[model samples]
Target chain A: MKRKHKRLTFVGLALLLLATAAALTLSAFEESIVFFQSPTDIVTKSVSPNKRYRLGGLVEEGSVRKKDDAVVTFRITDMANTVNVSYRGILPDLFREGQGVVTEGFFVSDVFTADEVLAKHDENYMPPEVADALKKSGKWNEMSSKMKKQGHVLGGGSQ
Target chain B: MLHRFANPTRFLRIASIAQPWIAWATILLAGTGLYLGLFNSPADYQQGESVRIMYVHVPAAWMAMFCYTSMAIAAGIGLIWKHPLADIAAKATAPVGACFTFLALFTGSLWGKPMWGTWWVWDARLTSMLVLLFLYLGYIALINAFDDPARGTKSSSILVLVGLINVPIIKFSVDWWNTLHQPASVLRMDGPSIDESMLWPLLLMALAFKTYYIWVLLVRIRAEIISNKIRILRLRQVHG
Candidate 1:
């Protein structure tokens, strides 16, 4: 082979090797790399209470209760299962009923004691006027149904 | 065909002609995009006025990845074909890509504070983007570390090729793993989930960022070519 062709072959082989290595490494660390686990994972896997992990899912509608102190209680659900979460600190600004949430803490007994809470917003973007109009026309359900068909439930729905 | 413009004189001539037009387009597009994103566009129903940050943040993120991909391709051509212009192009692209990466991170932090309740997170998407910025910085540092400029270009080209792996990783990080960062909205398998009212400003800003990169790239390439000429002239004078 010519010098140019030889160098091309060397680089091509190098890239292929590197890609395979990356793929393997990512797959191996897959469990740890995930930012949070859904309530379904915790329920089905029956994770031990000795270790701490993040629990993420939609905050169940009408489940938020604030006590006299800073403590707040809510239920996180992926529609298949629900985990009770008790948080003593302030929640993120975007935190609301039916919004996506991730809480990091320990699960002991039957409740999750959360030390931190982060809100996760959906990808949908629209003007408030449009949202208001949809609600007025009672077409909000139709819009949410469309989102469901696309495998995304923005708010107040099962995934 | 690539070799036709490999000559510095030809490259310079073409770049000179194209530079002013690109600069004007950048200015026009950025002005309109800013006006639409900041003033004309509607505030998001959920995020309120803060969603306007997406106009700048998303475009910066896209340009960061786009510039790195272009640099890697140019570096590859330089290595295999020994094209001097290609090497120069790759060298010129590093700092611009680094700046865009920084802008993305900075604007993202600003947007994340109120929205996500934190300035930064160790999620797959955010961490991969941070790695990209480091790759750019590492390339810049590696290129300048050598005493001989030719060796510098050769070694840095290899580094650029290696770092190309990070681009795809960054793009798919949100999907492959659970992340605090949201999944792709504009460039997903399904059409964009964003409404037309918000999508237009985003596209316009993205175009503006592209034109700005081309405008800066033309200037840097011209400077590199002129510097190379001066160096050759100095070498001849010393020998004579």
Candidate 2:
């Protein structure tokens, strides 16, 4: 019995150490994470124009327009506020209107110029930052309609 | 020929005979791969020196997936046939797969920082690969979770079999989703998009890693089987 107890305790301690290490690494990575901000937040906060940040929300219906071969402009709206964005190069297949996206870049001359854009493949999927932002705004359900339209069976029922 | 080595004693004998040959091949292939990667292969016109990471990252990723598939198949054999050695093979592969997954992720991140301009991206390919690493760790954890080794083996086998879905997901991620990660070049319907000079070394390194996996698996499984026999003997001695 004592021998078995010792082995069990050793295994338990090893697991605890492993879990702690994983958590520490995750937390460290989490701190560097910049949550996507909506245009509303950007407007209200008057965020520093030079600082790099991420903006995520739905690409507003009929807001995308091609400016040139190398430049394209669109609006990202959280349904309450919208920010104009300009991007260069070929867009991802999932970069359709009314889809959730996250872009990391900087604000230049009152316009958000994205250097990188991200879109999800699955229907119910929302970027982590977008989910957190909606939860904080108390409007995640209202926004999740987009998710529902995309066939998010699990998230659809919560609303 | 493959079935012949399914017997543990036969496997041990064959492995002992083949060990030196495989070891030499591994060394020669790896040495040549490194030399070609370092000196002969042309740098990407776009990516420059960072492209060297492809030599490591691609092989590690391939081996990570290969090891998991091998493990899951071994688990299946163990569950269905109650093959004594199959469970040992499955259990022995967990840490090796985990290490390969870690290497793939690590080399990928190093490559990503310069190429994609980020250390990490939640791109479909990247995310599913990350999930694979987690699955490997989960398998390792679950296998040791129970006091009864048999219980642990059975449960973890189920997990491994279920987690196999992530393999296809990783492979088709770029096609299924919009991701920063590039689509297949070497294994595509079209001929390899890569230059021949680079392709040869990468293929050789991949073979080297595969042989390395077989070598390590044999050594570890043999150790496990021996340890299990020792454990049974010790238990009998205690009871006697």
Candidate 3:
């Protein structure tokens, strides 16, 4: 009986300490916790400029600019609001105008200065993008109208 | 109250009855899941064929976290309530959870390279999940570190309790921190953001993984019980 009590006490103490440590660590890093924000989140929430973040949305059409070999500027949008993004690095091959993307960095004077850029989706298990495009142009109306009943836009075919 | 199942003979009898049923369910669910996931599912407007990786990758990721959470709970019960089968269940689950975590990380990387254009990133969701894999490895290693089986069980259970913090971190990482990984879509509060055509296969795959866990867990526990009998028999011969 005494041995059982001792074991229970030890287990109880360990759990309590673990809970305390986790709480402290979580509260200490509040800013680092906001992983990725939509453009509307940034505009509506008044995000601070100094904090690093991930900004994700559709890369705006006709907004991509290649000023130099490694430097690029573009705009990200959600069809509701848009945010300007600039980056100086080798862009991911999947990074293109008018696709979903995520950019990581801090804001610099109203511009999102991305340290890294990543495409939101990639071609792996699904059919190739070209096949999808071919299917879209041929049967877009029928497929989209079917999707419309479900109340959600088909991502790539939306625009 | 719980000592009713302390008898290995009784528990083994129950496990035998349940094992075959769980195994068959696993096969049936996986067959349907794969058919729906691979053949019937519509291609993602963005990801195309690469989106199919989610059928395997996401389910493995979910199982990795799930097994750890179950292990931690079993460890807590075994260590505190002194449940007989709980410790064996926890021990049996570690390797399976470790394997799932490894697959999740490997497949996630493979999918990432094609979609995100990088094989690796220090994103919170990915990194915390890596930490979970390490914790599973450490728990498995610690269990065998001691010459005394009871001592090893106690120490490993302690480690499992400490590592329980990682489970929540893994689940909320995409939401709590700036990560390259996308936020939750399937188990979201605002209903599933994924299209219904895609949601069916994902749910089926998740169910298949779950039934698979239950099937393997029973098999491992039975093995553990036999091993315990062997250990006891050897001790009796030495004493005699």
- Provide fnat values for all models in the order shown: 0.67, 0.00, 0.32
How many pairs of residues collide in model 1? 0
Q: Write the per-residue lDDT of candidate 2 for residues B86-108, one digit (tens) a residue.
A: 88899989898999999999998
* True lDDT of residue A147, candidate 3: 36
lDDT of 1 by residue, A41-134 (tens): 7888877788898988879999999999989999998777899999998788899887788899998789999999989887888899988988
How do the residues B134-191 of candidate 1 rate in per-residue lDDT, one tens digit apiece? Answer: 9999999999999899999999999999989999999988767778888777998878
Q: Which candidate is the best by DockQ?
A: 1
**What interface RMSD does each of the candidate structures achieve?**
3.9, 14.5, 7.4
Task: Order the candidate numbers by lDDT, best to worst.
Answer: 1, 3, 2
Error of 1 at B40 (Å): 0.1
Backbone clash pairs for candidate 1 read none
Range of the 10 consecutive residues with the lowest summed lDDT in candidate 3 chain B: B174-183
- Cα displacement (angstroms), candidate 2, residue B60, comes to 0.6
Quote the positional error of residue A119 for candidate 2 in Å.
15
DockQ of each: 0.54, 0.03, 0.24
